[model samples]
Target: MALAEPFEIARGVQTESETVIVELTHEGMTGVGAAAPSAHYGETTATVEAVLPRLFEVLPEDPHEIDAAHTAMDRVVNDNPAAKAAVDIAMHDLVAKLHNLPLYRYLGLDATETPTSSFTVGLAETGEMARKAEAAVEAGYEILKVKLGTDRDVEIIETLAETVPDARLRVDANEAWTPKEAIRTCRALDGLVEFVEQPVPAEHPTGMARVTEQSPLPIAADESLVAPADVPAVAEIADVANVKLMKCGGIRPAIATFHAARAHGLETMLGCMIESNASIAAGVQLAPLLDYADLDGSLLLADGADPFDGPPVPALDPTGVVGTGARRN
Candidate 1:
């Protein structure tokens, strides 16, 4: 799918990408899933397509072998979280549909307790970012996650905060800044933003800590926490943790990391790569555990062929997401 608007980060820019989508049918109960392989994580559509053939072999008709299918794929491959998430989410959808329950109900989460997700305002020229920020709020987003680290980071946030003062604004540098730049940037936009995410690169754990210490707003780690194994390190360093299913494999590991973050007294945000309804449905299943949410991938895509429809799954107001995880038309 093509991004309705360009999606840019410190690493590069994206306008379109080929994502892998899957359909796992059992007893005629078809479960759908989408996997958006991220170049940042060193994954490509070809790689995801290559790894998924193994699912047909190992996904026996246990019906509820969600964990087993994910595990089987992991044993065969090392680190294609997005690819594994495709099978992981389809199995979850299958389990829920087979039980005649919504995926959230199947997971036993209270729908009322799920937090509204934040809409993203991808990095752009200052004027364009302001317009997108305003548009997202007008579209019913209470929370907004703005991409930062450009020379105009301050200008962009200042413009957005001015445009939507009451709307909650958050900033992500996407590992673009240095320790000093992060601290200075956060200090400049302290009250303007709710938090600063991944202020520096994960490799610079020392820089992260220093930025965390100096920044007034809470500091969140995204690049630092990919797998559950990386949790302890991020927990020790940042005040908040961002968990993306694409980055961590799938639902089970994401939940494990969410609980792990809670145990470490860190705030959790369940985020996602730009995707379609299938994976967004799986990501939002853990909403009860998240302190923040950014599952706005499908909403960013450009048309009818995008394969996402309606609230909750595609969420009319992702900020007020509430529903089931089947293919909602």
Candidate 2:
């Protein structure tokens, strides 16, 4: 039997309130994965819940048959990203368990002892953001992603730069600006930030391209590159593409999107919605091939949720460097 459930994470302002958990059982081995729906993309808990029944109807008795599983998932991509991701992850987990290997190994990543991940400093008062940046740096985070697009964006970045002079900084506007505003903001924060992500809406790829060509810092596409179809357009305008399991629909499409980004010379960033470790662990499988990773959602949660409940797997160290182990840096 396949069991699916829901969860919520309280991320202020960017409150990610919905998640879907799926467990697939076959031959007494259970495979599990979690997914979250983004309201920004017209997905919700209800949408994922509505699709779970249909997914169960098509799941085959043999979980090891990857082709059959993929076919079943392809049939459900139209419903919602969260639902699709949940089902896809469950299948991947099943396959990994069948081989007695970690999920990252199945995805072709070398297991490392630790991989350093960035800590996010959400939108807040300039002083508050600066304090958070200082605290995060003190806590051993080498990279910081700042949420922007507010009236005080300049102040936020400026204060953060002042607080953490040596830390690498990036900003995500979530497509909250007009082309003119995006250009202006990018120019203003040019030297202060390493990269500015999805400043303009996805529909304005040409404008983003124009911004990328003129801006001092690199530009990354987040909401702009949701599928393989979006790759060409986003590549033309951006230097990087942020691939989220939720937004890309699932693991297969996320991999497809990564290849598409590589084909276009656009760097790939393996990102995630505000989700639990279950989803983040599943996403770590694609990390080795990515240029930047923002899979620290699990760390950001106030309550701990361990996706991999068994032995602790080696991951990247806090310095953004991969640790020595069976995993590669």
TM per candidate comes to 0.93, 0.86
Cα lDDT tens digits, model 2, 185-304, are 989997888898888877877788888888888999987888778898888889999999888777778888889999999998887777765666676666666778887665655443
TM-score of 2: 0.86
lDDT of 1 by residue, 1-329 (tens): 77776788887888886678878888978877778898889899998988888766777678587677767777778898988888777777777878877677788877676678888888888988888878878878888999888888898898888988878988889999999989889999978889999989999999999998888989999989999888788877899989998899888789889889888889999888888776887776777777888888888888764765534532322223332353655
How many residue pairs clash (N, CA or C atoms closer than 3 angstroms) in each of the candidate models, in the order given? 2, 13
Error of 2 at 100 (Å): 0.9
Residue-pair clash count for candidate 2: 13
lDDT of the candidates, in the order given: 0.81, 0.72
Per-model root-mean-square deviation over C-alphas:
2.4, 5.7
| Candidate 2 RMSD to the real structure | 5.7
Worst 10 residues of 2 by lDDT: 320-329
By TM-score, the best candidate is 1
